[model samples]
Structure formats: C-alpha cells, structure tokens
Target: MVEADASAPCTDPDIGNVAQARRRTRGPSLDKTAQTRQQIAEAALAEFVEVGVARCTMDRIARRAQVAKGTLYLYYPSKDELLRGVVEHALRHSAVYTALQRKKGETVRAFLRRSLLPTMDAVENSERGLLARLVLSEASHAPELARLYKELAFDAWQTYVQDLLTLAVKEGELKTRSVSRSAQLLASPFWMALVHNSLLAPDAPQKLALKPLVELLIDNLFSRSAGDNANVKSQ
Candidate 1:
C-alpha cells in the first residue's frame, strides 16, 4: 500500500460505473433510430389525415408522435420531406409495393392477378386509401404534397405495372401497342373505385366492388386462348 503500481489496471468502481453509463448514453442504436423515424412518419400521416396537410404543422406532428420538435426536424427537415417520408413508410407496408415473383410457368397476367387482386380489394378500406384520399383532396391546395404523391406513389405504380406488362408481352400473354398506356389502363379501375366509393358515394347503399372490376380488366388486357377464356369463365 506504500505506492500503487503505475501500470496496474484501474480498479476504481466509480470510474467503471461512469464508463458503463457513458456507453449506455452514447446514443440510440440503429434499430431505435429507425423505430423513432417510423413513429414520426406515422404521426405525420395521422396528422395529415385528421387535418388536411395544408393545416398540419410540425408541432402537432411532434406532439402526436410524443417526440420533441427538434427530434421531428432531425428526421424530416421540412414538411415536404415529411410528406415523402410518410408516403415511403406507408408504401413499405403495402402488399401492392411488395415485389412478388411469378411461379414457374405462370404467365405475368396470372401472376399479377394472383398477387394484386386481394391487396387491391382491401386497399380502399386501409390506411393506403386514406393516404390516397388525402393526396387527392389536398392536391389543389398543397401542390407539394401532390407532387410527392405523384412522384413516389403514382409513378412507382406506373413503373411496376409497366414492367409487368412488358413481361407479359415477352411471355406471349399480352399484345399491346403501348405498355405505358396499358399499364395506366390496368391501374385506372382501382382509382375509379376509390373515388366513387370514397369521395362520390361514401354513404351509398351499394359500394363499388373492386375485385371483379380488376379481374375483368385483367382478362381484357391479357390474350388468352379460347380454352383459357372458357376456363376462366367457368371458374
């Protein structure tokens, strides 16, 4: 005890405890950061839906998220950025945005029908529908929101459908003079149904049915042999 060795490892409990606390308080892990970002995006979406985007504010979104105002800004610097983030977050969970692989020997049309129909049928009643409605309702007033929605959602779907149509053409399942136009045609029914059911006739006695309309469009777009058409009709 006369003198402590200079090279000896530190045995101070206080020092060790302080080091451990520092490590713990260094920062949130990557997962925690992602979770927080998602929380903010969801909160923003809720605010935008409850109060139109034009009326929505960062303070409200931060309060809704239970995050500090600075925290919200850290994740999304501006309202337009937040809008983009919210749309991206929503699309991440949408089955329509999921990249599905066609089964071996499955035609592109069949693959699209099988993959998209169920999701499309339920989309009108989901958060996605609400987001679409928000975009449409605010488009005239909030041009930025409209631009983000068009760039992120509309163009994305158009590109995805165009790719499928291109594949169908290669597989001899479809013959179209313009895949781009065909893609637009294929996706038009969903928007029509969405508008009719939500904006035009939310309280209508008979809501538009999306599944049959999409199925009919698919059948019309894809070239099927007489037997295949008969088989589809029989089913």
Candidate 2:
C-alpha cells in the first residue's frame, strides 16, 4: 500500500484556502469567475481525453471553453493547476467523501452503506468515472497528479475509515488490533470496485456485488466471536 503523511493537511496549500476565502468574501464577480474556472476545467478535461494531457494545450482549452486564453490563466496558471482543478471538481461532486460525514453513534453498517455504495454507483455512471481513468493514465508521467490524488482523495478516505474503525472498537463493534491496517482492509475492495468500473469492463457481470460484499465484510469484521480479545484477528 502507498503511504501518505497522515499529518499533512488535506488540501493543497496553493489552491484550497485562498480559493475558499475568496468564495466566502468575494461577491458576484468572484462567483462568476469561479464558474468560468469550472468551465475551463471541464473544457480541459474534454481536451485531455480527446488528446492526452501532453497535447492538450491552454490554447485549445480556451477555445473549447469559449473563454479568452488570458481568462483561463487567471484561474489556472498552468496545466498542472488546471488538472488539480479537475480532480477537485470530481471529488467535491462525489459521494466518496460521505464517510467523513458519519454522525456520532451511527451503526457501522449505516456509515459504510451511506458512504461506500453511493460512491460506487456515482463513479460507475458519472464524469468522475472518466476523471479516474484520466488521472490513472496520466499518473505515470505526471507525479504531481498522483500526489494530488493522494492528498485530496485517498488520504481523506483513509482518515475517515480509521476514525470509523476506532469508533467501532470503542463501541465493541470491532476487535481489531490495528485500526490503521483494518481501515485499509475495510476500504480496499470498495476502491478496487471503483477503479475496476472506471478502467475495466464496467458493464460485465461480476460474481460479487458491492452490497453482498459489504454485508460479508461487516459480518466478518464486526461479528467478533464471544471472548475475543482486542488482539484477536478477525477470521
């Protein structure tokens, strides 16, 4: 498993606060500018998919967005920044982050279903699916994109999983020794489903469905045998 600095902030220093503050304080003009930036990002996604990232030029993106080249630069100073924008857009619009929204005292099943199932359905049908494919394809060449994916998406999901599992342990819903590793195991299959749907044969019939998988996982992970200690591994 690829490790990330858990202590690291979830958002990019260059993009997150500045833009968030602008949205909170600035009026219609900044809102309009934000919309324009989204337009450019969407256009850039189209251009990138049409002809891979290396060939997707700012000029082409501007034309596709029907905005001036200068206008596009005002939001994204470079293609890399624009790529981050695309990712941010995709993540903000997906249900993958809903795990972080779990209410205190909610059941493990409720939390997992609320977060995981919708995300699986969303990625299977939405532009986020295409975005995942695009990012994976470009990751080999653009390390920053991969880094941003970890920073913005993977780490946040893992952190939520860790928190949920920790809560489960305290509530006697789980008896895992390692919350971190258990969290990884809990989240891995859902993620693989998303990636498989995004990059593999999405429409093909699968032997396992996500709901049944979630049920079995919950049964195995949480249905601790009587007298099981904290050190007991789930079988």
Candidate 3:
C-alpha cells in the first residue's frame, strides 16, 4: 500500500470548510468594492440623467457620489466606462433580468417580451427619458459604451430569442430554423419598433406601446399550438 498522506482524508467536509473560510476572508474586500462601485454608479446616474451623457463629467459624478474624483477613477477609468457602469447597473437591477430568470414553463418569446415591457416603459417615461436620449445620442462618441449597450441589450435578447424560437418550433408557430437565425429574427423587429417609437412618435417613447405588441408578436411570429395559443400571457 502507498504511504498515507496527511491531507488525503480532508474529503468533502474539509474542502467545504476551507472554501467557506476563503469566502469569509474575501467577503469584506468584495463587499467594499461592490459598495464603491454602487456609489460611483449612483452618482453617474444622477449626473447622466440630468445633463445627458454629452454634458456629464467625472468631476460632477464624484461630487454627486460624495467620493473623491480619484475614488471614481478607482472604479471606472474613463467617462465612457462610467456611463457603461451606470447603464449596466440600472438594467441589471431593473425587473427585466428578474423577469427572465424566474420565469418557468413560459414560452421564451412570451416571457422575454413581457420582461422587455418594463424596459420599454422605463425608456418611454418622460421622467426617465434622459437616459434613453443619452444612450442614443452620446453612444456614438464612445465606442466602448456603444459596445457595452449592445452587449447588455442585444446579447441577452438574442439568447432569449433562441429559446423562444425553439419553443415556437415545438408549437409549430415558428418554422424549424437555426437558433442563431431565430435569435436574429425575433430580436430585430422588437428593436426596430423600439427605435421607431423612440425616434419618431412624440408620445411613443413615453407610452411603450407594449401591450399590443406583446399580443401581436405572439400572433404573427409563432406557429401556434393548441395549448394556450389564443393568448400568450406571460403573467
């Protein structure tokens, strides 16, 4: 028999104990970092919403957060990165992701569209419109921010579309299609509608117009199944 090793019997409980100890050791640092980031994001949101991204500055953000300018820099190196941080924080905390993750047995299209309505509502509300305007206007100036926005919105949207399309195929409402293509097919029209509303109709941005679209999208896009085909209610 091989000689026994002292650490060999550490096993699952020992390993878990070690992991918990490590987490405890790291917890303080992680919490502090998160709080700092939150402070920066809160400040950035106030600054961006009031001034628009073009007019917002790191100095203003620092003063608003009550953090030193150097502290803000510790979290985000540049203005664009700060903008991305703020947007990401807002979207991440919004009900959208919660709606997506907690949903079960709901068609992907139904759940995501339902989740998206909150975002649309946020974008459309006059009080909240400044973030949307800055997103469209100032995004062009910052390529990183643009990419972050796209990644934040589009990638998640695409992933959800892929799942919905797969379910749609089962329902026979959607034709058998590549998941990638399906993702694109489902994502474009909604975004197109968003852009149209945001850019054109005076009240469109404010109203969101999500209720009708949710119904229409299901009716037109899915192949339809016998079960729950009449009304695709995410609720």
Top TM-score prediction, candidate number: 1
Runs off by more than 4 Å, candidate 2 = 1-28, 98-105, 198-211, 225-235
Please give the RMSD to the true structure for each candidate, in Å: 13.4, 8.9, 13.9
Clashing pairs in 1: none
Assess each prediction's global lDDT (C-alpha) against the native.
0.77, 0.68, 0.60
98-193 per-residue lDDT for model 3 (tens digits) = 645636657555565676556544554532344545567667765666677677766776776576667666655455446577567544554555
Error of 2 at 22 (Å): 10
> lDDT per residue, candidate 1, 1-235, as tens digits?
2122223221322333323433767856778888988999989888888777767777778889999766677677667778888888887767887778777767677788988898789888776777888887888988988888888889989999898888767755567788999889877888999899989999999989999999998887775433443333221
Q: Is candidate 1 or candidate 2 better by TM-score?
A: 1
**Tens digits of per-residue lDDT for model 2 on 50-85?**
777665667777889998765666577666788899
Q: Which stretches of candidate 1 lie over 4 Å from their true place?
A: 1-25, 224-235
Candidate 3: list runs displaced more than 4 Å.
1-33, 49-55, 99-132, 170-173, 176-182, 188-198, 203-208, 223-235
Identify the superior model by lDDT, candidate 2 or candidate 3.
Answer: 2
The predicted structure with the larger lDDT, 1 or 3, is 1
**Inter-residue clash pairs, candidate 2:** none
Rank by TM-score, descending? Answer: 1, 2, 3
